[model samples]
Structure formats: structure tokens, C-alpha cells
Target: MKLTRLITFACLLFWLTPVAGQSLKSGAANNDEIIYHIFQRSFYDSNGDYHGDLNGIRQKLDYMQQLGVTSILLTPLYESAFYHNYFAADFEKIDPKYGTMADYLKLIREIHRRGMKFYMDMETQYVTEDSRWWKKAFGNTQSPYSDYILWDDKENKKPSTIVFNLTGLRGYDGVTRKITTANLNSEASKAYNLKLFSYWIDPNADGKFDDGVDGFRLDHMMDDLDNKGRLPHLFQTFWNPLLAKLRTINPKIKIVAEQANWFSLGNEYLQNAGVDGVFGLRLCFAIRSFDKKLLLANADSTLAMLPPGKQQVVFIENHDVPRFSYGVKGDLTKLKVGAAFNLLMGGIPAIYYGQELGMTGTSANFGATDANEIPDRQAFEWYKSDTGKGMALWYKQTGPWKDQFNDDKPNDGISLEEERNDPNSLWNYYRQMIAIRKANPAFVSGSYKTVNNDQEHVFSFIRKSAGQTILVAINLWDKEAEVVINAGGNAVNIIGDVRPVLKEGKLVVRLPPFGVGAWELK
Candidate 1:
């Protein structure tokens, strides 16, 4: 596809321009500001056991520091039989597959030493059958937690009988019965019933539970998995206050909830519930929209939906979801556009481990075969190091992706190492955006307004905080788009060299396809 450009004012005016009275912020402004995501144990592994460990993460301090990341949110590192650690067997100990308590503390120290924060993903629901609590709850008698977990067993006679067949859920690997709701309140349930608040913060759990990780990402926050209310009092009633107790151990911790489908009920519950932030599902969709109008529409809608004083965890890709490559079907141009949005737009941005470099996967049923499920789970092809073979390999060697290699066709000819060195690479684009966000508080904590523009394909917004103002504009169409910024103020373009001069109270901007521009009030 050819890019539309307009030549005016004696300069090549490509898509993307800046306007005035807008606020912007980037990593350069705050040394202690960052948002990070933890994924499957494939980022770094010293044992070569095909699983990433806490110590392996310790080895990559320089890489994270280079990105100017100030916080890390790890996936379920606490012990569990499941690969994702969403099924909790032991809430206190780090999974043996990942590492030990010493390794976890070392990783924490490493992150804190660099002036960063740490958090983990948590499953507030069931535990693995092997959990001591489950075993102790239901002895030899046939109980709902019989094999070890007590569901709300509504169907069975004894109430102890488990019920299965939950729709839209990827069932766990186990024996032959389904767990229903009737068993939850059964006589057998009383012994092993795990309350959401009591599990993770067990002060006396030196023996079985007690993984000393800081913070938590309430996994599947919007799901009614146990037949609870849509929002569930489990979190609002119990977990929120429980976090306060956990905070006694470390006061500076942070918590982000993974309420992926929260848009259905609105975000008030999450924001008002005292979480630091919730996943930005709407923003993720905005990045995926190749159409400029759709992009702006989604972006505007999301900004409108968010309650004041609350934050969204904006990310291009996450472990549980398909990557941008899958969404764009390996289209590099669209992928770049998505990355631009993730970095430039409002909210705390997070990048999945492999998203920086292009990785590919789809929603095909992997069946019992784990090899070909999602692209995000695929191993790092180190030989195709342009996109980041060494880092990818490091992650693969340390993670579950070790067995799947992409040797024949490396998705993109750029690696983390290669892009970091190239000034115009996506890696640097991200750096520039982060720098802009850090430099302007308006971008970080400012209120936003959609700039009215005559062009349908151009997206423009002003971010203002305190006395600072920054303008952000993007071209969604392949054709050149002319936009008029109505806000008052002479602004400097921070993303690139393209700048707009205000004349007669209007700043006109021309943007090329998939282009991004940022303007800061001078």
C-alpha cells in the first residue's frame, strides 16, 4: 500500500501531525514509573528445563531498565499444578517449575534495586486437587472437592458429587467428573472451603502456602466461574480489604485486576473497588482497528467510559489473549500501528514479552496438543535474531515455549537487540513515546478531550493536566488527512519533526496512513 503524503510549507508533510494545548508524558520524566507484565515461564531459564524461573528474571535487569520500565506484573508465579497457575494448589510457595522462595526474593530485590515495583496474577477461585486444604476438607468420603475442589454442586444427590460441563471454559486435565454448585455449601464443603480473603494472606503459612510475591492481578475478574454475582462480592467484599492486610508486610505494593470482559458491566466496580488499575480491553481493540474512524471511535468511547481517578492497564497483547500478529493476520504495517497506539495513548501501557518483536499465532483449537494453540505461546526462534533471537531464546529456554521453534520463517527481521540500536525502529518509536509520556504529566494523569476535525480519517485529542497541555493525532486512513486543532497554544511536535503552526486560532495538520504525532504546548 502506498502512503498518502502532502507537500506543503516547503516540507514533505506525511501522515501524522501535532496540535497545541495537549498534555503528554513518557518514561523519561519519571524514573519510578513503569507498567510490566509477567507471562509463562519462558522469559529466562538457567536450568534449560523449558521453564522460566524467578532467578532467570533476575538476569534481565538491564533489558527491563533499558526500556525504562518501573513496574512488573508477573503471571501466577505461586505454586499450582496448572501451567498458568490460575488453579491454586499452594498460594504461598513459588511453583517448583518456576523457582523457590529464595529465587523469588532475589528477583524482588533485583527489581527494587532498580527502583521498580512488582506484582503477580492471582486466581481467587479454586485450588488444585493437590492442595492440602482440599485434601483436608474432604476425606475419603465422596465430596464435591472429592478429587480436591468443591464447586457449587447443584446437580448431584449427595451434594458431594462434582458437576462438570461449564460452557466457554477450557476444562482442566483430570479424571472423569464435572463439579457443580450444590457441593459448595455441602457438609463436605465446610472443611475445605477456601475464602478468597483467607487464602493468599495466610500469615501463619510457612508450611504449605506463602509465596512472598508482592501485589496481585485478580485473574478473570469479571467471570462468574463459581456461580457468584457478575461482579462478585468475593473481590469487593473480601479481597480488597485482604490486600490491605497483605500491605502491612509491604506498604508500597500495587494491584491490577484482569477484568477482561469488564466493559459489559462498566468499569465502576473495578475503579471504585480500590484496585490500582484494570486491564484496558477497549484500548486493546482500538489498537487493532486499522480503520482510523473505528480507532478514534473506540478510543473516544473508552476514554468516556473510564471513571475519573481510575486507571486502565493498556497493553497491545497479553498472555491469555491472542497477540496483535494474530489479530492483524501477520500484517506488519497494522502491527506497527497497534504498537504506536499502545505507546502513545493514555493509560498505563503494558507489552507482552514477545509483542515488541513480531510473533504469530491464531485461535485454532490446539486440542490436547499444546504445540500449536496460540502464537504468544510459541518458542523464540533465536536464529532469526533480527526480531530478538537471543532474548526470545532466553525466554524460550526459560519458559514453556522451549519446544516450539520458528526456524524456517522468522516473523519479522527485527529483534529486540536490532531494534534498540536502530533509531527509526519500532523499539525506538516506543522509547520516544515513553519519553514523551514521562515528559508530560498531562499525558499520564491529564483529562482528555477529542479534538473536532473535518477529516474523517484523522484522530486528534488534547491531554491537559495542571498547566501542561499536549496534543496527539493519528491518521487511520491510507490517504492523507487534514485536521484542524481547535485548542489554543503554540505546540512542539514530540513524536517526529512534523509540527503545525497556529494561525487565526486554528492549527491544521496533515497525516499519512498509520502515522502518529504528538504536540506539547510551548
Candidate 2:
């Protein structure tokens, strides 16, 4: 069935909310809120074709709704040369392979009906060889799109200004790369790239751009082009104006950039571009490496680096990188703890698809060094009976389970379906942490203070806002340890997982092996 039709029917199953309220609240933060990542192709179809269609996602509105995900980030849904949808073939089309234009509209309607927002990933560089823009530019050297794409000039008289294709390819290879001299600047190339960008934002069918997209995620801004080291400035020239026009369509529109390579550069780039938020690389790296100290420290540092009122978007993983479980290599406990921290942290938290379950992959597979990674890019697991009452049914229902070929041996003891119903499961813990964060104002947009703990294996901190305080303590160690909480006052145990007692005006708490606990001030 068509995705729109499925969404319209699904709309009947839930109570709808207004679109205005779906915008981010100006105050601190809300814990129940979440951004769920979905690769455009991973959504389902009734035909059993195996490729995820828009309608497939529409059919599963209940799954996302139940999880309280406030926003859905669709990874690069635009038409691309590859299934991954990075190399843009046509920005206008909605990738017929995913679904029809109507299907996308239905998705927007269904999502808004549930009071949730949707974000589409936009890859800024490299359109396909056969793209209309490219063909038009090539055919008419003086056409409007002539300056929209890149091409190498074959004839160069001056030896000093001449350049060589480092990747051993032809001119303007956006895929491989090139190195140009300092004196050599291509006004024509810049104009061409900007023109193509303008086409994406051209909504009214006229040459002049009017209405375009809700927002954009600037791709590959960190890399230097032409060795100028002015990529951000170049982006601002093209993107800043485009952002202004997009905001005119919806004042609340958000623009996030993928400034991955480094945290400092990403932060600086976002600030310079006046973006709403930046992808949090620090949190992602920590979760992927299972280095608890580094994770907590990086989170702290990222928070410190941001200017007041500007926020960061936290995620366990994204499309460009490997999945957290696969990246972390089956450390379910660390994954759970990292997730809890992400939820409790002050920034907006994003969850990539298939992260809730413990997914695993090796460097040989996902790192681009080996050919095996292609097969490892398996789809999510959706439906299969829980083996031994272990929650296989829930896993199958929640996942695009057929994505993985080896159905017989799945990740050991990792299934969102099982955890959703089980109160003590990791899923339950996440839900509870979100609930606690939501109920308390301190956890939202509060000030963070690191409490001095003697044990290096333990990480502790407090969130204080509007005179309320919530302390979070994690036993990064494998064995039990004593947590000393010196709040200088009496605080109530909110989660009740860990019991504490007052001693000499300080709160002493006993932590279990690899345990975590939270407290609330009375």
C-alpha cells in the first residue's frame, strides 16, 4: 500500500497536536523529547521487497509514538546515485525508490498530527554525472547552471599556477580530489557550485529561488577546498542567504551542520554560520569507544565550549559513521550507561536507528579498510519470535530485522521489543531516565557541577537550576564502590535504585558493580 494511505489510517489511531507546540520550548530542556534517526530507505513496504519505503515508516507510527520521539531525522532522502543517497542525482525528486512525493507529504502530515517534527539530511557536495544541473551546465557554458558544477581546465599556460589531480583522475573530481596552487583561484568554479545550490532552493519553478527546504545539514564543511582553508566562509556566502529564505517559510526552522572531523572546528563552524545546533561528535566518540571517563569529560568540555543559549545535538551514531553497538563491539552495559547519560545531559539527544538494540561490527567491516563492511551495512531487525522468552518477538516487531542475513544468531540479549515491556530492561532504564529528566527542571537546561569523587573509576555531577538540584553518579568501575555526595544539604533519592545515608553532613551511597544512581534535592 502507499505510505500516505497508511499514514492517514495511522492518524486515526492517535490523538493529534498543534504544529506550533511541536517547536522547541524556549526554556531549559525536556527529557521526554527525542530525535529518532531513520535512513530514508530502511522504512518498509507491504510488497516484501526488502527496501524500506516511506509507507513502511508510516505503518510504524505507533512504534515511534510509544517511544516518545519528538522528532525524526530522515537521512538524505533526496535522489542520489547510490542507495545510501549521498551522491545527489536530483535534489527535487523524493527518490522514487523510497516512495512517491505523496508518500512524503503523508509522512509530514502524520508526524505533525502526532505533534512531532521531521528533519531531512541534505548532502551539499557532489551531484551525479547525469544530473540535470550538471548536463545543463556542460551543454551551455554560459547557462544559469554553468557555474553550478566543477570542471578542470585542461589548458594551463602558467606552470606555477598549474595543478595536478592528486587522485589520478580528470578535472573537477568531487569524489577523488585535487590540489591547486595558492595563486590559482577559480571564480568560475565558485559561481558554478553556488548556482547548483541555488537550484535546490528554487521552489517556485522560476530561475530565481523563493521557497525551498525547511533547513539544511551542511555536509563536509571541515575539509579544505582549493587549499584556501576558507570553506566555512564559502559556505556562509552560499548557505547563509539560503538559510534566511528557509526561515521565512517557517520562522522556527532549524539548521544543523555535519562538522564531524573535530569538536572545536565543528563548534566554531556552527557558531560562525549562526546555526541552531551542531552534531555532537564528543558524545558519539565516547559512546563508540566505551571509554567512560573520556565520554563524560568530552560531554563536559562540549558544554563548556558552547556559548550561552546555543545548544548541541547529542547522538549515539549517525549515517556517516558506524553504529554504536557495532563500533563498540558488544558492550551492552556501556551502551546502556552511555544512553542514560545522553538522555540526562542538557543537550538535545538524538538516537540513530538500531541503536536501542546491541548491534556489533568490526573495524575491518565499517572502517573502509576492508571489503566486508558492505555486507555489515545490514538493515535493522524487526520481527522474529523471542528465543526462550528472551524478547525476540519485540525485537522483530521494532526492527527491520530482515536487514541482517544471519537471522539465527542475533546480538546476545539485545532487543527493544523485550526491554520495552520489561521494567528492569535497558529500555526501561532509558524510559525511566527520560522520565526523571522530564520531571526535574535541573536536568533540562541547568548548570552542571562536577562533584569531587576520590575514586577515578566513578564519575559524578550535579545539575542545578532554579534552586533545584539533581545529582547523577555512575560507577565506571566493574566492581562495587562507595560514592560520597557532599551536597552540603539533605537530598532525596529520586530513582530509588541506589540507597544512600547521611554521615557527617555528607551523603554516602553504596553503588553496585557497574551501577548508576540519581538523587533529587528536597
Candidate 3:
């Protein structure tokens, strides 16, 4: 047992297809959008430089389709000195390391061609000194973009470290210089952002809408714009107005905000910021930890805060935190439980690129540079074979945690090459669960109702829509248990090896540790 390994949609029966006025379809919720979020530099490399690019992602569309993903979320593609690309050097061009603007445009066209949604992540809150506005307007009162950037003093040239304030903090070496915050309220800033944002939604200028991205992920989204939460003028003056303008240009273009301090504070952004979706970080943690009570309470409380018509993005892991697999110490059974919860949960289910492969990484000590968090964004392990073709260890010798990410670790239960065909692997578990969800529409656009089961180790719920319902039962234990979950339905379809016999209208089954099953009710 030595090392290494690893490892949609339809529409319209007069259903939620894009209409003439709406560029994005609603009503389907996130279940209809199985999002695959990728950090480009760590994905697949097509250029042989060991750096992944837009072309690399385009090359893997078929692989994504095979895995049942209908949407893809890419980290910010704008030119940047930072590896994460959240702080942009230029909002208009694709980073040369990624490829040309031509290549990016081509990728977008292909993604939409395959009936998939493409979402590009952007911060729009900060920019590097290399930005055109920063270069021209810093300490220059006469320049048109002078107010576009925030300076510590009207006469000072150095940009304020902004909200997160990394200027003086000491850590890794990448950010030797400071990144300035954008004065979001300034007409010049909004005007510039609007232009950049507009171009991505309808890149061809034809207004066909199909050729460009379907949405944008607003990174570090907030209502006040600062940690103090005192500058509460932006949502009313900045975001709402800007989003309204964008909607006028392309009504279906979706906007999702990564609410500032998302795990604890997101409802305000969703309720007042006018964004289409916000990340449900609290719920994500609940599922990952297998806290049944907390998971239910948090989900119900958070969902109640959102006004009807708004949705939250639910995921087990993203680029920001440690991988779920690592959180559970790479125990494959727990990994399967986490996967089932994420994919089958309510709201939009986003899959971090290598999450399905049970990839494990941690970056708890982030500092001056992305190098501090590099381990979490390690290259996708394409195979245990060739050391290079798919092993995109772009930050190998540079990051602080490089040694911690050696893919050769024994019993990793990771790597796409290792898990692609293994029936019991985490990769296949995701595929099977996704298939079950897709076949049952209720799981996608249904109402979530918590089912009370007397057994303490079993957690249950029903996803119901119209006349159909599917009860999902999960065993959050480490040992097999024979239990009866009081789901008022007969099993029409069963998943995994565990089968629950119906007795007195209750589901009775002996489930292995961390087992999951779904029943289509009569």
C-alpha cells in the first residue's frame, strides 16, 4: 500500500433556458451548475513550461465534461505580479504567463460551445502599482484617474495596503512593494471597472452574449469596503448601481460575491449588495467536519437570511482554505462522506479542481507572498507516471511549504491517474453522486426539508419539488450501524452497497462507516 495515487445539464421542457431578456437562467439554483473551480497555474499544462495556461484548461474540457461539470470558475486572469491574480497589474490583458488575449477568448468560445458556464474571478478592489491608473494617478492630482486610487495622503505616492493591509506585515518575499486599494466610489474607478467587466460579458461587441463569460466572481466582496465596517456607503453608492448598469448591458450576466470574512459574514452582502450568489462558508465547514447539528442549524439559519430569489455557493474547499481531504487527514471514507454532502447539498455546488482526487494540502501560515499558500494550490497530479506532463508544480523550489507537497507521499489516495478508474475511489464517488443528483431533478431545484431520525449517528433530509422527492441519508459514524431512518418513502433507487429495507414505512439498513444513500420516493 505504498504511495501515490489519486485521484451538465439540460434545460427546458419550457424550463429554465436563457430567454431574450435574461442572460443567466434562474430557478435551477446551483444544483444545475456543477462548478469546477481551477487555479490555472496548477491545473494542466499544455505549453510544456510547467506553467498551466488557458490552453491547458481548454484541452481538458472533455475531461471536465466526463466528470459531469457544467460550469468552470477560473482565478482572475488579468495580468498580475501575484500568482493568485487577485491584485491586478492590468485589468484588460490576460497574463502572458497564461497566454494571449486571443487564447483566452478562444477558450471562452469553446466553453460556451459545449453548453458550459464560464465564471472568471475578480477583486476589483485592489491593483498593483503597475496598473495604468496607479502609474498615472498616484500623487498626480491633475490626472483623470487621480481619485481612482486611495493614497495614504493626497500628496503621498505610496498606496494604502487597503483593507487586508499587507504593506507592513512580514512574511514571504513576493510582495516587496505595496498594492493599493481602489477608491470604489470615485467615478473614474467605477467607470474603469465597468468597462473591464462589460468586455468580459460580451467580448465580441456583437451582444450575442453566448461568446463571452456567463458570470464574474467578485472576490473579497463587502458592504463597507473596510475591516472596520464604518465606510458603509459602497453598496448603496457603488455596487448596486454598478450591478444594475451591468444587468442593463447583459441581463443574464451573473455576479457572485466572495463576501468579506465569508464564513461569518455573508448574508449582508447577499441581501444588500445585490449580487446573485454568496459563498456559504459556514455550511461548508459544517459538512467538512461532519457536525450534523451544526450543519443543519447553520444551513437553515443562513438560508433564512437570504430573501427569496437569491442563492449561496456551497463548497467543501476552495483556493482559500485547506483541502477537505487534508482536514480529515486523507481518510478516504470520510472523504467520500464530505464529497456526497457537497455535491448533494442545496445551492450551487462548486468543486475545487483537484478536490475529487482526494488531494491533500495545507497553507495555514500565509504571509507576504502566495508562496505561503502555495501548497494548497499545488499542481494537479495527472499521473504517477511521467514526472512532468501534468505535474504542474509551478512553485516547487520557491514556496515555504514546497517540501510538504511532495506528491510521492505513500497512501495519498490522490492523483487523477491513480483514481480515474478505481470504483471505490473518491473520484468515482463524486461522479456517481453527481449522476444520481442529475437524474433526479428534485435534488437540483427542490425544497430542502430536514428529516428527523431517532438514530443519533444518522442524518437525513428530503429534497422535494412538485410531486417528486428524494431522501438522502448519511451515516456519520466510523463503524457499521443497523438503524432505521424515518423517511416516509419507499426506495426506488439506491446508491452504494448499503441497501435499506422498508419496514413499517421506515428505511432499515446496516450502513458502513461514513456511508451515504439516496432513495427516490413513491
The residue ranges of model 2 lying beyond 4 angstroms of the native Cα positions read: 1-32, 154-215, 223-232, 263-265, 287-293, 327-331, 362-377, 385-412, 416-418
lDDT of 1 by residue, 1-522 (tens): 000111221121121122233233221121125566756465666566656667767777777777667678777776765555655566667788777766776677677666676766766354444666455544444444453344334332222221123311232232212222222223343333334333443334562223434556776553333334322454545455555665665564566776634333225545555676677665565556555554554555455345554566678777655667777765555666777677656677787766765666543343432233334555433334323322323323323443444432543554564556677666666666667677778776666667776677777787767777888887776666667877667878777567887878888777766677788876
Model with the higher TM-score, candidate 1 or 3: 3
Provide C-alpha RMSD values for all models, in order.
9.0, 10.8, 7.9
Q: Please provide, for model 2 over 1-522, each residue's C-alpha lDDT reduced to its tens digit, 9 standing for 90 to 100.
A: 000011221232121211121222232433334788776464444345556778778777787766656778777777764555655667668777677877777776677677776766766445555466555655466666544454444222211211112212121112321212221124554444445444434444463322333445665443354233433354456555656655554566677776634334255655576677777765556544444566555655555455545667777665555556664455656666767667766677787666665544422221211122222334555533323321122112322322333432554455554556667666666667666777778876676666766676777777778768888777765788887766546667776566677778777888876677888866
Total backbone collisions, model 3: 10
Q: Candidate 3 residues 198-229, lDDT tens each? A: 88888878989876888899887777776645
Model 3: residues >4 Å from true position, as ranges? 1-31, 168-175, 228-231, 303-305, 364-367, 397-404, 407-413, 497-505
Top-lDDT structure, candidate number: 3
Estimate TM-scores for all models: 0.77, 0.76, 0.90
What is the lDDT, from 0 to 100, of the residue 438 in candidate 1? 75
The deviation in Å at residue 277 for candidate 3 is: 1.0
